[model samples]
Target chain A: MATATIAGADVTVDEEGFMTEFSEWSEDIGSALAGQIGIDLSDAHWKVLNFVREDFQAQGETPTLRRVSKVGGVPTKELFQLFPKKPAKKMSYIAGVPKPHGCV
Target chain B: MKRLLILGAGTAGTMVANKLRPRLDERDWNITIVDQDETHYYQPGFLFLPFGGYSRADLEKPKRAFMPKGVNLIMGEIDLIEPEDNQVKLVDGTTLPYDYLVIATGTSPRPDETPGLDSDEWYKSVFDFYTIDGAEALAKKLETWEGGRLAINVIEMPIKCPVAPLEFIFLAEAYFAERGMSDQVELVYVTPLPGAFTKPVAARYLGEMLQERKIGLEADYMLEQVDTENSKLISYDEREVEYDLLVTIPVNMGADFVDRSGLGDELNHVPVDKHNFLSDAHDNIFAIGDAAALPTSKAGSVAHFAVDVFTENFLDYIEGLPMRGEFDGHANCFIESGRGKGMLIDFNYDTEPLPGKYPLPGVGPFSLLMETEANHWGKVMFKWMYWNILLPGRELPLPALMSMAGKIPEKVG
Candidate 1:
């Protein structure tokens, strides 16, 4: 099992590689990830996060990478550097969605 | 032997003074209004100023000209409000005692609250349509602008006429289109709200309208500061939104005298009873318009309706009767949607804006939440009504209270 501590909240990765609790994920994680990727979690980032969450809630599914890239103005390569995996999974993480299987 | 002192000879105070002047016995009660400026601005006309639809002459009138004949209008800076003595001191060290005090100092645009917003780029790159000066400057800037990315940003919530920013964008789009430069401009609406508006149905409808007009919606954008040198609006988290032209609705604060008087909240807005418009800090003190920390939208229509209710209650207080809670937070706004079309919204504390005919119900000349040319015309005509009818304290044909009679209420599933 892999465990990640974000903003003093322990996020545990189960044997199947999914986060146990999504609500535990904090904005600090978004900030930390942004720092790691050499990006700032700015008004623009929150705007994108809110938009993605809204789109997901409306459509019952995550938006494609192209749509997020277009709306967020963040390049796909930059997004990958921030997420390091599936964009949907990263969006889920950023948007505080419960981790799906095979995502650490 | 009660003396009534009204502060600020603006829309709200003027209305209060005029409405009560004839009602109160001149020999028994004395009324005085104090303000620094002599000019009364038709604030709604500020929106049209940026587009050359209005001028300084069209927007301003002598403060005393519109006031009631009997009400004493004193032009001077307010030094402080002495709640204990029930008197307002002027900057000249003169004190006027009052049995009842009405605070209508209104709100001010504190552009300095946002870092670098008031820098050299202000009215050059960053502009606000909320002020007459800002509007005039923006007009000149827009005239020569070749156009690129234009962003309308709201720093925070509880701004005057919450929909004015959206209206500005819509009007700008229409303005550019009229000049055949619409294609050269990329319009973006940036706000701290979760969507285009606060109300759910209005937000959804307004969001769709933005999409239709090809306007970008940057929601939940909490502005941390303005990077004027870099031409970027930076959020608290450091996200940067680049813009060629920034139309900002700055942080609005109540009268500074409120802070000096120790009678205001953090934002300097007076704490008042939501329904009755009576200041909780002092029994004799009342607040209306942008000065009061009311839950209603800080718009002219809200002030008009509130003063209407306040007029009734103030009369009762004079007669030594109990106050009636008649104000329902009734707000009516005409939202311009561009291309000679607009939408009218009427709602109150309990009711959300519903779609249907307005005023006349089934046979209304105006439609609510639905865009129509007639609504746009109504909005345009209001400038005249504001000066001729509303400001003079004349009785309007329509009721001050919000009516759901003509609206088709949305059924909640």
Candidate 2:
């Protein structure tokens, strides 16, 4: 399993998505993933990313865009900009869910 | 040369403008609305604002944005209403003559009505969620606060959205729990109402919920004054409740122009027939929403229903026909209880909230007087509906009249 840093939190990822531990991540891998999705590891961005991940974990399913919007207080468009491809799937990816079928 | 002039571009005034704008003949009759401010606030959303659930932008929009195209939006303070002359004087020294007038100028929070409430502790320990500023400020205070005794006080009765206090308490519990500070924070609810709610069944249910959540209840406490220096709210007969943080629903009073015009009752609300919504003081004038002293809840649903009736009645008057004695004082509200669940209540002048199925009879997606996750979704979804559907003068799928189709009839003697 490979790992990366997203929004200052260390995260592990396999061929599917996020893995469990921060220790598996390297600085280069973290910066590459951050570059793939144009977002800085700012505190505000971390707050939203962490909240969405936590909400998905508690609900045991991926959250819809509106649910993420309400809890994060971030506009859907701005949230979309942070995760260019399949924001919901990317949220799930960062949240440690297996990449769903048909998601790149 | 007949014209209609409406005052205050809040919920009530905006509804009247939209409802009548389509019905009135633009060539023969002109419609004008007046208000000092430019923005219209979605008040129900204000309850969520203090919890970082909403921001100022989400709660407000340009008042003119929602107003119908045919109506003239007059942005100015109303200096006086000369009812005898059928004229309204604006602060800009302009006199507007009207053949008929609709006073929809709603109420304002009077925190100063209680002694020392507006003192040094005004926005510090003591706060109100009625205004944008108050809600935003309270949000900041709630963020860092570790824990202490937190009291939600209703200074008196007849405040807009009566159930908001209870919602605040419910959401607060969820908020503290989310922040892992639930154990440190103590919750108390103080109100003049004899029970946790106005109705019996809901009251008992909500009161028990309060207990379950470890929230203290002090009912029938008529507030005398705020002893700010000591951080205590004192009641008549010298009873006192101390709080590290005090959130209050201040005394709500009607429009200032009503008092200026001497056309209102003790609280400056216009006297109108409780059923008909016609001004008792004048034949051509009408009042609706919170401005009208109706013996119903001062709520958005009430205004929506009242405007539905007012539209029909006004059309009858224009055609020189008899008025229909409709308007059953119907009001429906969804109460948010946090933790992804909520309760729905539907009642009117003659009926109180009773447990039953709603809108679909036995197959309801919503249950009255019962808490459910679907009801919570309904409450959250309403904000979108308010902005896109309700405010734009669009007709919704739901009927304006309260229906008993989903409700089981109460057993009677």
Q: Which candidate is the best by TM-score?
A: 1
TM-score of 1: 0.80
Docking verdict class for candidate 1: incorrect
DockQ agreement of candidate 2 with the native complex: 0.01
DockQ of each: 0.03, 0.01
Which pairs clash (backbone N, Cα, C closer than 3 Å) in model 2? A12-A19, B361-B406
lDDT digits (tens) for residues B1-413 of candidate 2: 57999988888788888888888888988999999998888999999999999999888899989899889998998889998999999989999999889999887799977888879888888899999999999999998887899999997667788888999999999999988998899999998777798776678888988998999999867677888999998875357999999999998889888988987765677878777788887887888888876667889888888887888888898778877857888888898888889999888877777778776778768888888998999989998988887777677666667777777666752
Question: What lDDT does each candidate get?
Answer: 0.81, 0.79
Query: What C-alpha RMSD separates each model from the true structure?
Result: 10.5, 25.4
Superposed Cα deviation of residue B271, candidate 1 (Å): 1.1
Name the lDDT value of residue B395 in candidate 1: 92
lDDT of 2 by residue, A8-84 (tens): 65666665555545334444444455555564555655655677656656644445554566555765555555664
The parts of candidate 1 lying over 4 Å away from their true place are A1-104
